[model samples]
Target: MEKPVHHFSELFEQLGLASDPDSIERFIQRNAPLPETMPLAEAPCWNEGQAEFLKEAVDEDADWAEVVDHLDASMHKAQ
Candidate 1:
């Protein structure tokens, strides 16, 4: 079977963060422009559990990987 697709809100919820659209937007705005040299999992904003989850998702290429990449790109966007 194929893996279940996930949305930005779901990814945020998985990270134990606010999952609503407005909250998600605000979060991205607040944390945008993550350093190009810094990995998403290494960003200071995430707590240990959230950081571990992001790292594993990317490392394992799990079902959550796409959305996690989206979040990383969103964070790295030009402000």
Candidate 2:
């Protein structure tokens, strides 16, 4: 079984992001918790494709869904 992702940096890699520490930290610092009302799929941090990926993951409950959910929850909690 695939190991679960446990950190933002890991999630970024899983999602094919550039997961360098500085980039990851910048991403976190900039996005943190999206506005309480914004949906994860609509968070401004995402480009069009990234947002679509997140939306489909959540909508289809794809394998990445769990990681996406984790990220969504974490971001929301950061608020």
Candidate 3:
């Protein structure tokens, strides 16, 4: 079985996003944060596939659920 993704870095890698530390840091700094209450599937920041993946993790509470939830909260918090 594949290992679970516990950190944002691994989650990003799983989602085929920018997993590089510098890129992830810059992404966090550059983008507008999503609202805490917003559905990740409906977030403006995600592409359709990325949104679907996040939604699936949340809706099904899959192995990636914890990481997805953490991402949701982290992406919503202001610096």
Candidate 4:
């Protein structure tokens, strides 16, 4: 079986967030720099469903995990 593939914008959309490039960038800038000690799923910025989805994506190593990790890294990066 082929592994599934996903993208950054798709993950944002899955999180019920704005998925356009500029919106994605703005979202990152606004919520980013997630603390090194914080897990992405535990970020206060996400609602219950969004948080569950993020946690599942990473914990289950689903197809979404790659983009989720990318988002995590993006959020952790310095402006």
Candidate 5:
């Protein structure tokens, strides 16, 4: 069986944390280097749709305050 190579971005996504390059770089520098390979079950899965959504949201020129307000309302409803 082949081992898996993980990027810092994948690790943060799996841990439900921020996946920005700076954050990932800091995490990798602070922690021990990860193995070049791992079991498939332990590997992280990438989602293209999620990435696209994020890009679209970030690229929008509209006021983010309204977006934040909607998100907060949605979260409150979810709870």
Candidate 6:
């Protein structure tokens, strides 16, 4: 499925960041491309179950805070 494109305001709201163009640009520049290598020694592996869970999470129509919280909890549990 094609990912829906969002405005900067949407991204800022989702991230709980300031909805300013400069701030958004800085964030984009700082974290646009994630590194291919794992940053930690014991990074969580992405299996089929996790992938399905994430796909469901992303595709759900829910509040941004709830979605972020769910993702954070999942990552924390995986660690």
* Top candidate when judged by TM-score against the true structure: 1
For model 2, how does the per-residue alpha-carbon lDDT over 5-58 read when each residue is reduced to its tens digit? 456666698667878889876766778777889899898878898899889988
Clashing residue pairs in candidate 5, if any?
A: 3-37, 4-37, 4-38
- TM-scores of the models, in the order given: 0.96, 0.72, 0.79, 0.95, 0.29, 0.37
lDDT: which is higher, 1 or 6?
1
In model 3, the runs with Cα more than 4 Å from the true position are 1-5
**TM-score (C-alpha, index-matched) for candidate 6:** 0.37
lDDT of 5 by residue, 8-66 (tens): 45545744657898875564454323233432222233256543333344366223324
lDDT, residue 76, candidate 4: 85
Ten residues in sequence with the least summed lDDT for candidate 1: 28-37
Q: Least lDDT summed over 10 consecutive residues: which range in candidate 2?
A: 2-11
Error of 5 at 73 (Å): 39
* TM-score of candidate 2 relative to the true fold: 0.72
Q: Candidates sorted by TM-score, descending order?
A: 1, 4, 3, 2, 6, 5
Q: Candidate 4 on 52-78: residue-level lDDT in tens?
A: 999998999888989999998998887
RMSD (Cα, Å) for all candidates, in order, is 0.6, 2.9, 2.4, 0.8, 18.0, 11.0
Candidate 2 positional error at 6, Å = 8.9
Query: lDDT by residue for model 3 over 9-67, one digit each (tens)?
Result: 88888778789889887776665477767775677777888889899988998888988
Ranking by lDDT: 1, 4, 3, 2, 6, 5
Considering every candidate listed, which one attains the maximal lDDT? 1
When 1 and 5 are scored with lDDT, the better candidate is 1
Candidate 6 lDDT tens digits, 1-79: 7456555466456445666878755654544333344321123433455444444544674343344333334334322
> What is candidate 1's lDDT per residue for 1-79, written digit by digit as tens?
9999999899999999999999999998988889998999999899999999999999999999999999999999889
Which parts of model 4 have CA positions greater than 4 angstroms off? none
lDDT of 3 at 16: 84
